[model samples]
Target chain A: MSTRRLIPGSAELRAEFPILAREVHKRPLIYLDNAATSQKPAPVIAKLVECYERWNANVHRGVHKLSEEATEHYEGARAKIARHIGASDPAEIVFTRGATEAINLVAQTFGRTRLAAGDEVLITALEHHSNIVPWQMICRERGAVLKVVPITDAGDLVAGAFESLLTPRTRLAAFTWVSNALGTVNPVVEMTALARARGITTLVDACQAVPHFALNVRSLDADFLVFSGHKVYGPNGSGVLHGKRALLESLPPWQGGGDMIASVTFEESTWNHVPHKFEAGTPDYPATVALATALDWLSALGWDAVAAHEHTLLAAAEEALGAIQGVRLIGTPAHRSGVLSFTLDGVHPHDLGTVLDRMGVAIRAGHHCAQPVMDRLGVPATARASFSVFNTLEDVAALAAAVRETKRLFGA
Target chain B: MNDLDDLYQEMILGHARQPRNFGALAPCDRSAKGHNPLCGDRVTVYLRMDGERVREIQFDGAGCAICTASASLMTDGVKGLARPAIERVFQDVHELATGKSDGSKDLGKLAVFSGVSAFPMRVKCATLPWHTLLAALDSTSAPVTTE
Candidate 1:
């Protein structure tokens, strides 16, 4: 296929997702909440159907042709994801339920074995609870301290405070490559490099980054990296966890079940090798293949063009929202992804969100499961809109138009 | 602009604009902070009762019009009623808002929030203050669950 742009045009982009074909309160649906979860494209849905129709079987234990084919497809998905992220070895990648589970696996297995009392783990203010809560649980259990790196008012990480927090006792530094709440694309390459010099484990929750930007874990120097499949137009209940070979080899198995054991006995049992060791039970066979197909499609649309398309939407939205009176945009960092969070002076976010929904413009309006970030911003809640490659300038305009109508209705 | 078509009614806007009995009471006997995590609706209910008679009730917080108006009306609903009667009123208001109990419902201007139940997502916004007032009657730290 020729390297044509994903945004054939605003109308063309709007036609891809069949969900957008539906009406909301008799108005056209303008979904702008990609940050929460994106609508799956037709190709991704077709891939799901194809997996069930042709390649459906239990993987890795049967010598039958069907099982062999299913195993091959599952492993093929692993390879596709590994290649997409520039992962050096396919064995470095492990299939997980989603990014949340992948992060939990590291915290449970690695944290249980590698860390102990007085050891500290550093996380940032920008993390979703998925990243923060798991580490907090592990730290509390293992008698380790959890340190939080603050962020500037502009939504940029307070680099100086982060540097100051680093100590010899610090065992790991986990942060998002791009924040899901605020769109700040954290400089993980610099962050990982700094941690490595101090012999600290560097973890990157790249669920938000892998969807919108090009990434190479080797270049970023991340000891562990994770991204979810659903957010990238793949099927749900699938994710990828990439870890350095030596590090994965050292950690113990997280769950005990089928496909993770080499041999089992009444008394003793042995575990499977690296990637297989982490993947327990019957894996999500069809969803895994679809995730790989989605990644393949994203690869075909080169990151540069994809990034440019998303930037266009973000620029359009920022300019339009700024022009409206009493509208304040949160997370105005110089470097950000396409997510936009904002508040109007007199309108409650709940009421504002309700108005937006009735107008067929869907945006997230709440704490977004990141209450800490909300507290930091001094807002009880704010309405949020996130963009993706499929979105266009027109969608941003719909959001602005909806906000203005809300202001008018509320007499703000 | 009379737009009942808007999610908020005039009573809701009025309460939000000039909230009656708004602000913290003087060293209240019972107080509890109730927060709706989803919408960030928060209300602190302060009550001072004399024996079985309700003396005073006040509240303060950041919330949507539904919650603010509900808080404002809640004070009026239980001001003259006794303790047992107040509890019954709580039940009656809950039943009325949820469409269980109708005629003779002493909901007052809270009747405006009857439209809110249609939007399931906004239900908590209307009930946040009621939950806070429930807590303020007699409770300790840590949020008390209504559902």
Candidate 2:
């Protein structure tokens, strides 16, 4: 097959990720699971190793030189993440374990404070379990109902469903910028704007979106936005929650710990500033620095090139897989990212995934933590192949070939 | 195909395509549900007990080849057996599926599951039905999870 170039420098960029060069099952790895967690590049890995070897110290409280440098690096990551998400103030960025924790932090603090009995929290059917369960927990505790906006069979959010559900009892609307299971890029800007017009707060789960393109949370005007570091080729346990500073300041702290406190007595205590109060404990300093390095790398690549390369991979895979005799593509939303979830006739997703693994094509299979979407689509699970900047047309071809092989094994 | 032949053997595939006892039993005396949330595999085992013996046993659900086939084989292996006899078969099958023991001669057709121990992640799939059987025997309603 002839190689097709989408981005000018993407070929060279692929070399930056060392893991891409390795072999799996005696064949060169065709890493297509980027939507799950991207493989880290050399610079991001180097930054993590450098942090531990050069300056390993706790942040915010230590008086020594190593402590001051560690504090600088950690806070610098906070600033870099703030700018990456288009937040105006660094104080609005709070580091959490990942996107799940970020959403839970908002649900526990903001959801607890604002929501009252009979209030409603709205989300779409396209949500991952992380986006759904946290609100379910908070709403259950607060006597609030959880309302779901319907989606069309094409996996697009239903037009007017958002507005129809935006009743007076609706206190908050939290939804994903992109569906992890379906790859449907949601119209979050219009959804957030509609919710804001109705005086309801909004939070956007950009965990799938932030990796593919540049996101301007301020431009979207959502009260809160979140993304995971690992999904963007950074270290695990690194994530950022960006909130409007005024909104964050008014919400009470969720978890109490050493760093989140400004003053403490036996009977009385005062909380720290907005970000620190939400952070609660000692943060993963090295991972945060590596996350910033990842942002710097993506910023250098620019969103245009990243999206172009990924779209080429997605389009190629879609065409090739859709042409196969028994392959049924799960979602073909009008607007989508690089995720492709599909099923082969007579082949269970687990069986397909096992066969693909032997061919050195790593893909995700199962409900993808979006059982509602799977139920809506009338499937138990799907085999999903998500593309990233480093993925090429060859990778898509390999995936299509492996899928064909899976069909053959099932005598299809 | 050669690499996965051990996992999706012809016998397993045949059973998956046509699983035995793949329906709910009416007048079922005991029943329990088993679910593997990771893969969305769910099975509800129903048993009709005549005193301490199982008169009829069946399972109804959706799962991968290994899971469905295992449940099919399990009902065939344990039906009409007394409580203690079924318990003994369960122990032998568990050991075989988990690589703890080679096939016992008494286990008869259940020896096909010995290949399951090679794939660690799949061991749970092969044993989910057996666990659900135990749950049914104990008359517990809580769903078992192979996390």
Q: Estimate each model's TM-score.
A: 0.95, 0.96
For candidate 1, report its TM-score. 0.95
Query: TM-score of chain A for candidate 1?
Result: 0.97
Best by lDDT: 2
Candidate 2 residue A270 Cα shift, in angstroms, is 0.6
State the lDDT of candidate 2 residue by residue for A1-412, as single tens digits: 0133334226677788899889988899998888889999898999999999988999998999999999999999889888888888999999999999999999999899999999999999999999999999999999999999988889998899999999999999999999999899998899999999999999999999988889898789999999899999899999989999999999999999889999999999999998999887888999999999998887677688888877877888889999999999998899999699998887778878878988999999899999999999989999999988888888888999999887777786
Clashing pairs in 1: none
Q: What TM-score does chain B get in every candidate? A: 0.84, 0.92
List the DockQ of the predictions in order: 0.59, 0.70
Candidate 1 wrong stretches, greater than 4 Å: A1-5, A8-10, B1-6, B82-84, B99-106, B145-147
Residue lDDT tens for model 2, B2-68: 5477777788888888999889998799999999887778999999998888889999998988889
lDDT of 2: 0.89
The digit string of per-residue lDDT tens for model 1 on A303-322 reads 88888888888888999999
